[model samples]
Target: MGKLIISVNTKEMILKSYEMGADEVVISLNQCSFNGLKKISLEELDSNIPVSIFFNCCIFPEQIDEYHSLFEKIQSLKIQSIYFQDPIIILWAREFNCLEKCIYRPETLVTNQMDANWWYSRGLKSVSISPLITLEETLHMIRNVPNSECVIHGHLMMSYSKRYLVSAFTNHNDLPSLRNNYDLTIQEEKRDGHMPIYEDENGTLIYTDFVLESFNELPILMKKGISRVFVNGEFLKDEELLDALSIYKQIMEEKDVQNQIVSFFEKYKETSYSKGYYEEKTIQ
Candidate 1:
């Protein structure tokens, strides 16, 4: 069976998630104040689970000094897989001879099969499909790259930027909050929907109006040989994350757990969830 991979930023989750049936780990520090790079050096002690560092901090091509420093850190680490959002960082990865360990996450936008194959040919292990694509496009992606990953659950990242929009308006532009994921959120004026917004070193990031719940589609994904799943637990409390993890674990492990999982969700109506683009054939 395909394994479930959850993205986390805490030392506790980094160590315990695999115990909860997470087949692998994606350590995301973008949402936290702690230096994730340093934290990985200290806490990445568990060798049983495959761990990938989620690097949202991408630099400009002209930043040669920064690239040199980053490459040194990359070389010093024992990790092999890295989930990064910078297209330009590919040059740094190649220079450091670590391109094969890179899993390009273009939260900048979605990607397709042709794009996945293109990157695979270049040396990247795999790529993430855009959350905005249609179910048909999603099928084509997994069929094309059997090892490619897609976000199956969590709040979908709608947008990202280098500027902190919140701090700009709050008169705290000079001070980037170094706390855990902030509580600031934005709601659409036209509709009764809201998206979670947070800021850190990488800059401002926005999430979808509703949680992306594709639990019912697990059967199709698993049957198609889709190998990996990206789960988000950075914002969830311990109990909430465990419960969410349990639901996905059942869906992947059981053949006839769809109805039960649906019932489980119906019983817990805590988060307003949606199927997103799962029902559509293509994005318009």
Candidate 2:
């Protein structure tokens, strides 16, 4: 079976994840302060297990200079693995000769085996499967495609837009800052549940109708040929992330996990989460 990969933006989160048995650590520069990461030299990283850096923003044709500078910066650091969501940046990485270490992080709609094959053919070592597809569909891709990965728990990415849709209409500097000081989740007039929306350097990202939790289905997925599972808690806090990591590790390693999962759902029942899409067809 594949291994577990988790996104940890802070130094504390990274240490905690390693303590909790994460196979790989994904340091997201998009979410954390770069100054903190800059302090972590290659020697420090070299001493650690497999680690990947994430720069979730995209590059446009007009920003060719920016693209060059970004790649140079990453290369100068001597980091080996990275994940980028932008098509232009992916191409730049390919041309810059680090394509083998670059993995493609696609939007949550790439479910077809042909699509996975296309990316693999382009020399991407790995591709993240969309969480919107059923477990069976995900398994099919895992069997047909090499080095395929998918999210197993936490919030799901529902939609993404290149434009800063919310900030465009507001003159207020502090947008996406609700009364709760967190991302806002709203339900449309007739929508089933609340969906989280936030704007970052990459633009607006919308989550699914509810957080996606597949703790119980994870073992089956591993058995069915899913070699890798990503624990994506980019929207969560440090404490929450630690708890989440421990829970996933426990479920994966412990023998009596059914009751643990049930208890977890009970504790967070007020917070909406589900494995609905894992059993059903893709959402329209």
Q: Residue by residue across 115-175, what tens digits does model 2's lDDT show?
A: 8788877887688887778888888888888888888876777777766655664537654
* Candidate 1 TM-score, true structure as reference: 0.83
Candidate 1 C-alpha lDDT tens digits along 235-271: 4455556666777887787746667667657765777
Per-prediction TM-score to the true structure, in the order listed:
0.83, 0.81
Candidate 1, pairs of clashing residues: 110-130
lDDT of the structure predicted as candidate 1: 0.67
Clashes of each: 1, 1
Largest lDDT belongs to which candidate?
A: 1
In candidate 2, stretches whose alpha carbon ends up further than 4 angstroms from where it belongs are 30-50, 76-80, 172-181
- Which stretches in model 1 have alpha-carbon errors above 4 Å? 30-50, 61-64, 74-80, 172-181, 255-263, 281-284
Any residue pairs clashing in model 2, and if so which? 2-227
